[model samples]
Target: MTATAFTSPSLSGTEALLLDLEAERCDAMKRADFARLREILHPSLTHVHAKGQIDDYESYFRSGGTHVDYRQIDRSELKVQVLGNTALMTGRQLLVAVRKDGSGTVRIDSRVMQVWTEHEGRWRQLAFQTTPLAMSVT
Candidate 1:
């Protein structure tokens, strides 16, 4: 395994674009911007939460992003790699969110991995999974 700094000059153009798209996705989630998410997320998207919950594209989008009320997302230590038409992104994020059912606000410090693929000239996220860090790294 190799660690590359986010600002490293060795990153490929595709890697940089994926990182930007991922950032936009995080921002869209926090702001409840479904239109932007629709553009970024693939039709067969799979999202796995740090708490073991799973959501597919329809399940997540049908809820209109009301499943969680996101207060903030702090992403760091991001790395992106591109292989042919696929891109992989990994990062650490500190998220503050509350369940829509009034379950109270919770803070999550996790490591995230995302898969993005280019389809018909557009890059869309296909999969996302997060693992809670044993100790807070953020």
Candidate 2:
């Protein structure tokens, strides 16, 4: 998958950099590039799924290769706020993947919030949470 281009002129340098890293993270997940993911995610990372499951850095990385196969991860409407050494990012994410436990595929359309911080001279994702958008009544 091609990387999402960040062409908005209104974004600050930090915001642009953070969004670029976010895109890279999504690409890494789709490609199962755990090595690169390790560099971007913090040791204390907390990832909360839309289905209410939570995973830390280790479990999150481990699940990528063994428990779930990611097909696509798309993000849009991204906004980032920088506060001192920390950043808060919010966006919409569309994820499609399959479970290795014979449960077939899963797709999530949700609003995501992520926390990142400057650690050891590099920005690393510290936490992530998703809230599923309510389904429209037919």
Candidate 3:
């Protein structure tokens, strides 16, 4: 079977940088590396969870219970738009997570929207919101 092609074009350098930063953020999350998250997130960053909880950068790093082995992350349906120094990214993500237990695994599909800003020649995530996608009716 041939893989389908997906494309999302970025308009400016800031938008491009945000895409790279987001990739790094995913890698950091998979490794549970807080430092990487810190580097990519703005000091005033706000993260809205799937459950509608709001957390600041420090709070997010402090909250535990994030342990999971990520088998795969599929990011698609990306739409990036730039307005001045701010860029907005919306996409769908499919991630497979394996618990510490040797028993079973869980798959999560979500739609995410993230805002990024350029400050001092660097791009940082200013805000992020994610919502869980309903299961597919197959």
Candidate 4:
């Protein structure tokens, strides 16, 4: 993986737009709005869960509401960078959710990475991955 610096001098207009879209995506996940998510995610999307499972676009959507149901997502230390028509984002996420198996609420802290590509005048998320922190949040 190529490492690029995420120095926040100031966010450009493009960066700000992408950042908002990312936030909106998080909201969609929390509410289990599958239609909204489908609009925002790319057809070739790939997501690597914090637990180490990888999901393609189809499987990712299937997991939601079946394995885990997101309730809230709080992002911090988020950084966004734009390269041509693609944007890269990285941040820490505190996600609160419940298992579909009715175990209980789970609070997870993780490092997240996402890639968005501009297509047909709209940005669609192409890739996402999360790495869990050593200790999960309560």
Candidate 5:
């Protein structure tokens, strides 16, 4: 783990939980486990796609067209901010996905921000937004 200059104990715990959630989400995506995804997401959650499309929890689960198999994901520079019962998580993620046909692969590197709220003593994702990171010109 890289050293961070500033840290908060509460934020640390939130960050840990968010990281765990991200891992579980990745697993669910790989297995197309809608049930698990449903559990993690709040009832009124909204997911904003990179393509300017917005999906509510119900719509996202019903899409059924997200069949890409994720090969791996790399996450870094995560920060969590806690406000009362809500938390905001921000980070960078690199994801590699392959089509089921085995024809090719797609890689995406993006910056993500997610809002999670504690409901009934458990945290659930309320909203998530992601933006593709611009490649650096070396």
Candidate 6:
């Protein structure tokens, strides 16, 4: 129920800051708040979906509601590394999405890698990619 990397005694304050920013980014996505999403995303943000589709910042914003609506996102197994002005984040995400009819939800579990840049004491998402994970057979 915890991320060891973030809990490590050797992890610096910068690491914690980046981790917090990551949480904020996830919240923004679930809410689908365009303004917050725009502010958090870099102008040149690059996003790669699990199906290998690529999206730039403007494309992503413009494609809202046609498909790919996220109702909730739960992140786990997070590892973050801060390198000067950028942070790299890897984690497992459980994303719940609404059906087109709005009657039900579907879950997509994926492994995600996100890149964040620090600018003038603020963090912005620069790039992100997610890979779908096959469920384990018990």
Model 6 CA deviation exceeding 4 Å by range: 1-10, 64-68, 100-104, 135-138
Best-to-worst ranking by lDDT: 2, 1, 4, 6, 5, 3
- Taken over the whole model, the C-alpha lDDT of each candidate is 0.80, 0.83, 0.72, 0.80, 0.74, 0.76
Segments in model 5 whose C-alpha atoms lie over 4 Å from true places: 1-11, 100-104, 134-138
lDDT of 4 by residue, 1-138 (tens): 101122244768777777777777888887788899898999899989877888898998787534778887888788887899998999988888888778777887889999999877899999998888843533
Best by the TM-score measure: 2
What does candidate 1's lDDT look like per residue over 17-52, in tens digits? 777787788789988999999899998999997767
lDDT of 1 at 10: 73
Q: By lDDT, who's the top model here?
A: 2
Q: Note the clash tally of each candidate.
A: 0, 0, 0, 0, 0, 0
TM-score per candidate, chains pooled: 0.85, 0.88, 0.76, 0.85, 0.77, 0.81
Would you give me the overall lDDT of model 3?
0.72
Give a tens-digit lDDT track for model 3, residues 13-127: 5555566677777777777778877888888989986668898978877652254566666777766788888888999887676765655676768999999988678778899
Q: Residue 68's C-alpha lDDT in candidate 4? A: 76
RMSD to the hidden true structure, all candidates: 4.6, 3.2, 4.5, 5.3, 4.7, 3.9
Clashing pairs in 4: none
Q: Report the lDDT tens digits of candidate 2 across residue range 29-133.
A: 887788999999999999997768899989986665457778878788888999999999998888887776767887878899999999999999999999988
Give the poorly placed runs of model 4, Cα more than 4 Å off.
Answer: 1-9, 135-138
Q: Rank the candidates by TM-score, best first.
A: 2, 4, 1, 6, 5, 3
Residue pairs in candidate 1 whose N, alpha carbon or C atoms collide under 3 angstroms:
none
Preferred candidate (lDDT higher): 2 or 5: 2
Candidate 4 global lDDT: 0.80
Error of 2 at 15 (Å): 0.6
lDDT of 5 by residue, 9-125 (tens): 555666667667767776777777788988889999889865668989888876522656767666677777788888888888777777766767777688989999987878899
